[model samples]
Target chain A: MDEPPRSAPMSASVPPGGGPGRIDRRAIVDGFPLFVPAVPFGFVVGVAVVESEMPAVVGWSTSLTIFAGASQLATVTLAGVATLWAVAVAALVVNSRHVMYSAALAPTFRHQPTWFRWVAPFFLIDQVFALVALRPDGSPASFRRYYLTLGVFFYLMWLAAVSLGMVVGPAIPTGWRLDVAPAVMFTGMVVISLTRSPAVVAAVVAAAVAFLAAGLPDRLGILVGAGAGVLAGAVAEARLVNDRAITDEQEFTP
Target chain B: MNMSTAFVLTIVIALGTYLLRAVPALLLADRELPVPVQRALRNVGPAVLAALVVVSVASTADGGIEVEVAEVAALVAAGVVAWWRRNLIWSLLAGMAALWVTLVLV
Candidate 1:
């Protein structure tokens, strides 16, 4: 996907250059560890497809077409037995969190090309969002390179894992505890993101609410908790600004 | 379900999901958001990550939330390593190790 150093107009948005090759390499390295947990999760989705009696091809195709694991699991598991609308709604609601991810990323995507904007969201999974959101100041060119490289890497990895799962899924014992890996990965991600006090507030509040509302239907608690945490963090930030302003005024008056 | 029925359902779900994801970027492209919205968006990463942590580890049981001891051990170990080393791979390894050790002992 390298464009051979285009003219100034096209390349103007490029940051004080990381060299396209370097950024792609860095993106792959950064994405590798995060991508690890998805293997077992994909296996679960594959097992769901087998149990549902869906065609293996159709089950595998969802990995490419839908690309979101949770919803894919829901859709595959519920497809035949559930009402058509029920299956659709269940999957869509599971994926509704992507709306927030998209909104948060809109500003970064603002300066991207028309084609990039159109194609980029196709790969907007949780890991991609977390990685891009970490480097909010990246240039449009770098952003495109990093996002696509990482996206494709994850896509290929997921496809392979799910395929492997479909073959041996039934034989694998559930007690192997493949599930613990993703929880650990997510915990590490949360720790990495907690660089500021207000961010800590956000994480804590979000965790508390999500745990309390764990029974919410269709995973709506995820959204509800996240929204509350954002509000808490924003409120904390506004208060900090006000307090600093007050202290500054007092010093100036004296 | 028949292959054709599953195929049609897959297409429908995929289309709806695509719109949910793509519309925000297309509509808000290049537009500056309000200050409050920006502040909230800033926390979206941490907040969502935290929520995901809970979703992964906690599930509804017969009547209430049931969290496994091994998973919680994994989370604490991972959190400490992540904070101390600031490395994802190390933290992940630590958490997995902790999970297995706790499972064996318990």
Candidate 2:
């Protein structure tokens, strides 16, 4: 893959030049830990994604649309080889991890209100989770502000990094063609993220399913594999719960 | 991958990903996540990631099983770096560097 290097001045999008401090700076600062990996990761993804089949502009938008790194990358790569449905399914499953994030933060956000509930979770990425998790219990209003500020801050950083990444790609001639820059940078970050694994059964089941379906058109094999893995893992999980119940019963009888 | 398709997918994914995040916040308030549900959800991450990796590696651009040694070597380098350093940036950097080196040297 041709790793397209981003233009250097993309950093110009960083702080001070943009005087928009709606959210608390503290919340934004809280996300600093992620800056290291995220910046480079965003840039790399942008480059790889542009290298894929998607156009520069569409590739860039995944940062906001999906807002998750790994899923965004999967979306691009899958889009390159598979159909839209395949890409969509893969993106959803990859991001299904956020279901946990949403559930974990649900209690914290429950009191906010209908509109807030609807809009707030849109910003709930891993960094936001980190910031929220670390926070000492506080008033709901303060919590909302804190979360949104960090959300905005993280959003800006991601956009900028991706935008910076685009500068390295083609078609951006550096004369303030805003669309070109934004599109290219977003493309830079499309490569995406994964960090963990499961037991032998889930892996084995999923691989088998994917392999079996590998011949299906539009790369639908992975969807079948993902479904099977989930099914198998669910069975495993339920079985473990059952075994635990049996053990408890035996102990009580003794 | 027409421009319109890319645009549509981007919009759909944005909507889909957003709904995935928003629905739980709207609906799951005050309810305990059932054990089975939690377990299944937990597995979803690994299953999807694993499935993606397998399919991605196995199915080439032409939908055939062929391992590009250069890409595989880079991926291995990335996996090792990520696990060893336990840092995402370093892992990616190491992988990219390794891929570049492998491409250049061998």
Candidate 3:
């Protein structure tokens, strides 16, 4: 199958006095909005670590070092079974999306110097990918620079927020209901994902299957739900492609 | 589960999590994916995010599969803000404010 056309122009045509190949400052500015949501959610993850009876250092270090909110939350909240094996399994399940993010953006960076290409994946996150995909103008060179800057900015924000959350976790009242933070973040992601119809069907089916299977032990609902969702989405996407191909062939016939 | 032991476990967890995140990208970076694998990767983001949303909303230990009104309301409010404004800050603020109010009033 052909790749989807690049959503944005590859470059901003330079006017008489404009510099060539400069990164867009507006895209970076646009990314600031993402951090506002991320910080409170980070704080909530901090609260989860404390409430789950894990040490503050685990919460802080995991947030800083691991740097993915969902997996960190799953690790701490499920700390009853929180063996090294379980945590590794949960982290693998949650972050497997990054492989997709990296692959989607790989072609854009195929021509970049090898070092930059290697370093770039370290900063790839959902928010960074969304912003890069939405940028209106950039050459491959400019896009690479823009994406790297955006990634670093968000990465630093994540570190700072997690650090602040760790320090402030004790002071926040116990009954403050920080659990909503994860829900908010997850809802935002879901809403963004729902932009496509196949994704919506996948999400609904996955949630239904997960609810039905919630009786399974050892947090296996997550694994089952995620697996079912991916299976459903892949099937739906394949069907959609096949339908479109048939339509194109019919249109080409005399 | 003592403090020092907890700290050690946390360090282990942190290392485990990082290795999981980093290793796949490292291992798969050089390999060209098959068409089916590429298609599967494309669907992974939405599928994973969707599963996360379900788990987040429905996994409370309330002894039944009841929707937490406050959580659901907060999520809907947040979803609306995100859709309408596409601004993460505004969406979060709206969601948090709704949740806080629901918590207070209910």
Candidate 4:
């Protein structure tokens, strides 16, 4: 795969739908990259559910049914009084990015059927979205189909890992080892995040803020850090773009 | 909460989570966002992920701020793996290995 150019213009021409020949291959090819990360993360989440004193079935069902890893982790980790509300809020916040992901791909997917449209969103995880969005010439239908293929594969992997972890929960030694899971997951997220322009500064600033505010109650520090990072990145982008516009205008002046 | 209550809570939480994950895609299905707003949304994932990582590493035993060398080592290893390969599995493996080594040695 070639390294994508920094800011290539999106293709206005709509490519033919993957039909049967290309869509299946595209899905499998794109989906394979996601499986590796999902397994470890799923295992960790499974372990977390057991640690929370919840039944192993709950973990398995949650992973199998919901299939949203970050939200699942946040929900189980903070499982306490009014935990339902907290999980709801956190999941909403975390998944808010999907809207952007879907919107980015909408132009390509404008031709897909409503049924396909409705079902495609459920599988719109970060990896699926990234793969589809990065495609050189994928149409909306192709993107949706590709995402569903990835989603199905991911869902299966997640279910298997969670089940394995839940079944073997007692045998897995407890301690610092479990901590490695989140660290690893978060690290991958951070790296992917860093590839984009403005996120580097945002991540650094948010890390600093989170470190300072780590004492806040009920994991509010995470919220604060996230909010700060978004605000920082938005401000930076706004300023940079504004400055560039001014420079361009000045250059164009008579 | 009691076992039954916790079970109910878990169910509620699970449902709530699904709703959140689904809502954004559902709402923005066919809608087109302004360029500026779209750009802002683009940064959300990275920002949120970074915040999560910061909190995870900085979070202390008593819920206070404290930096542990092991955690720092893990973070660095993870960052290196991610930057070098851009592969999630390798990055995670590197971080986990770093954490395990640090834990055993320290």
Which predicted model would earn the best DockQ? Answer: 1
Candidate 2 Cα errors over 4 Å, as ranges: A1-22, A169-254, B30-106
Quick one: ranking by lDDT, best first? 1, 3, 4, 2
- Model 1 lDDT tens row, A1-254: 23332222223222333234333666777899999988889899888888886676897899989999988998998877789999999999977878988998887777777878888888899999988876645456767777877787788898988888888877788876887788789889889888878899989999999898777877777888888888899897667668775432221110
Q: For candidate 3, what is the lDDT? A: 0.63
Q: What value does DockQ give for candidate 3?
A: 0.37
Worst lDDT run of 10 residues, candidate 2 chain B, spans B41-50
Over the stretch B16-62, how does candidate 2's per-residue lDDT look in tens digits? Answer: 88988888877876565565655665455445445655565567656
lDDT of 4 by residue, A166-237 (tens): 667556666745655665666676776576456776677777787787777555676677667767876766
Interface Cα root-mean-square deviation for all models:
3.1, 8.5, 4.7, 4.7
What are the runs in model 3 whose C-alpha is more than 4 Å off? Answer: A1-27, A44-64, A70-113, A124-126, A129-139, A174-176, A213-220, A246-254, B1-15, B27-32, B61-66, B84-87
Which ranges of candidate 1 are over 4 A from the true structure? Answer: A1-23, A246-254, B61-64
lDDT of 2 at B71: 53
What TM-score quantifies how close candidate 3 is to the native fold?
A: 0.70
TM-scores for every candidate against the unseen true structure? 0.89, 0.54, 0.70, 0.73
Q: Which candidate gets the maximum lDDT versus the true structure? A: 1
* lDDT for model 4: 0.62
Better of 3 and 4 by DockQ: 4
**Of candidates 2 and 1, the better by lDDT:** 1
Sorted by TM-score (best first), the order is: 1, 4, 3, 2
Error of 2 at A2 (Å): 47
